[model samples]
Target: MKVLLKWLQDFVDIEDNPAQIAEKLTMVGLETEEVIYTKELFKNVVVGKILKIENHPSSDKLKICEVSVGTDTVKIVCGAPNVEENRYVVVALPGAELQGNKIEKVNIRGVESCGMLCSEKDLGLAVHSEGIILLENSYTLGKPIYEEVYKDLDDVLFVINITPNRGDCLSHLGIARELSAVFGKSLKKIISKGPKLIGQTKEFKVIIEDPNLCRRYTGKLVKNVVIKPSPDYIKVRLSLCGMRPINNIVDITNYVMLGYGQPLHAFDYDLITNNTIIVRKAKKNERMVTLDGKERVLDEKDLVIADTDRIIALAGVMGGANSEVNANTKNILIESAFFDPVSVRKTAKKLGLSSEASYRFERGVDIENTPIACEIAGNMMQNFADGQAVCGVLDTYPLPYEERIIKFRPSKCEGYLGTKLPAEEMEKRLENLKFGITKKRFEWDI
Candidate 1:
């Protein structure tokens, strides 16, 4: 699992650098396989503002821009189509080195270009179709762009080589809980309460026809959403966490998935045929085009999210394009529940559609976190998409699983560590991690 240091800081305040934290975490059991430092890659890039832009006297397709690097202004020849005046752009000055390349005063056509303007692609920051990044007004000119861009940007991705038995550690919260235990700190989380429905959710019928394959299926409807691109902060956070922002609706689902480790799906309410959602085995001749626009044929072993008319999503894998949220979608049905991991895994492998959501779901997310994740996504949807709260939640389950209980003796812990730990210290560590303990036994019944 890749645990970003910024995300880790949200849960615990550790007074150590990423490398030191990685080493400490390694000593405890969550082995750190690699530590990536992005700051080192961007050494001398600075924010620059385009003061003026004029057509290159020599080349029609080129533009000569006077850019301000805070201390001084310099002329640069740029060939990009989107260079404009009064925009903040990244500038690599002459003699500056970055990513093993040195920027030098060079002649382009007949002009002596002293520096080069950068695009997201050029800086290896993001993949955008635009010419150059029109940085937000917040960036101070001449400041080291990397520091401004990557501040609070210590991401120590712990490639935790977890054993198969530790399926619980597959999630961020689960990992945080474990670390809290290891470091004797507290783990806290903010869970949302699902949107208040204006009407009963039973009006929109839901059925789990294949209970064996779909262990649980919980859904909630939200209305009056304005589907637009997420805010800049939301987009950046998603990118920092290694996900591309699609739209507000899709981004909310992905954001909640990353924060809480539970996969979620949002379907356009109007596109769902007959206001029905059914969980069932796929038919032999069933075919679906997923959101990525790939046509996939289904097998009998595959579990699907279908309506009376057609399959809307590949269960626990991906949503179909036909029922996906679009710019015009106003009402949506958010799905957050558990699918049989074995079945999801088998179907994903068979269909060759293994997304991050599917990968985590197939491995097994914390069942207890389903509602919390759903709540977080719902709240984000309302806030980011201008979505309205609906009254009721549609929750269907075959059985309720109880919390896990494990016992650890104080003496046993000390013996295993081969270090002396007082009973008070051991209890404090376990309690900090949310483990409830009696004087005689240690138990976590949440």
Candidate 2:
């Protein structure tokens, strides 16, 4: 799992550098495999505004742009059709390096070009881009791109070696929880005060066949969604965290999954047959095409999420292509569920398919995070995709999660660790970890 330092700071207030935090995490058993400094990729890149544009003396397509970088002004030769005076843009100065190509003062069409203007593709922020990246007037003129314009890029990435047993640490929220416990800080909560729902949602229904295989399923209907590229902040964070930003709906789901440690799926509501979602065992020889465009043969032991006519998703592994969100999709059904790890692991291994969602499912995700994740996704969908939430959530929680209580004796724990610690100290530590404690005569129920 790759944990961004800035993202971690959102949950816990820490003043330590990357190396210091890495050492602390390593000491606490969340082994930090590698620490990467991301600002190196964005070094020397600053925001600049075009002062003026003049026709090049030697070329028809080339134009000379006088750009102001706060303290200095430099002339750059650009050939983009969108270049105009007073437009804020990304500037890669002469000493900067972008995508391994170093920028240097060069002569273009007999004019000395001091630096290069950058596009989204040039900065590794997007797969394709047509013109230079434009900045809003809110950005400071001479600020480094990593410092303000794209702060997510000016970060340290920690490659953590998470054990299979620690499935709780697979996401940013989980890691933040751990750090908060370790540092004795409070974990900041994410609140989603979304758009008001009209009434009880009648658009879709959920049915779970076996409560043993699936613990809980929660869904929200978002309507009138516009499919487009996500905002710069969302896309940049996704890219930095190793997820390709797709359309707005899909990216929102992926972002919430990474943030909450809960896997989520968005299905095209218009494609769901009979407006029903049935979670049950797969029939023998059942075949379906997944989102990756590959047909897979299923067995009776495999768990599946089906509509009235056919399977729409492979339960916790992957979604079917038939219900995928597309450019024309207007409404979406966002799914958040907790599937049994054994069932998900078996199916994913047999099908030779693995995804970011499946990886968390196979190890085990938080059952209590189902509705919270749906709420977060819905809030983001409204904020990013121009989507509206249909009043109520469709939830079928056959087996509700129950908190586990363990009897803990402070004396026994101290003896096991060979440390002399007071019972008050032990309670303080457990409280920091968010463990509920019930005081007893000689022992505690945690």
TM-score of 1: 0.86
Q: What's model 2's TM-score? A: 0.87
Model 1 C-alpha RMSD to native: 3.6
Q: Model 2, 38: alpha-carbon shift in Å?
A: 3.0
Can you give the lDDT of residue 441 in candidate 1? 42
Distance from true location, Cα of 241 in model 1, Å: 3.2
Best by TM-score: 2
Best model number under lDDT:
2
What do the candidate models score in CA lDDT, each in turn? 0.76, 0.87
Q: List runs of model 1 lying over 4 Å from the truth.
A: 57-59, 79-82, 92-127, 135-139, 146-163, 192-203, 407-421, 439-446
**How much is the lDDT of residue 127 in candidate 1?**
44
* Candidate 1 lDDT: 0.76
**Per-residue lDDT of candidate 2, residues 136-217 (tens digit):** 6657888898888887787788999999999999998888888887777888766645333221357888888999999888
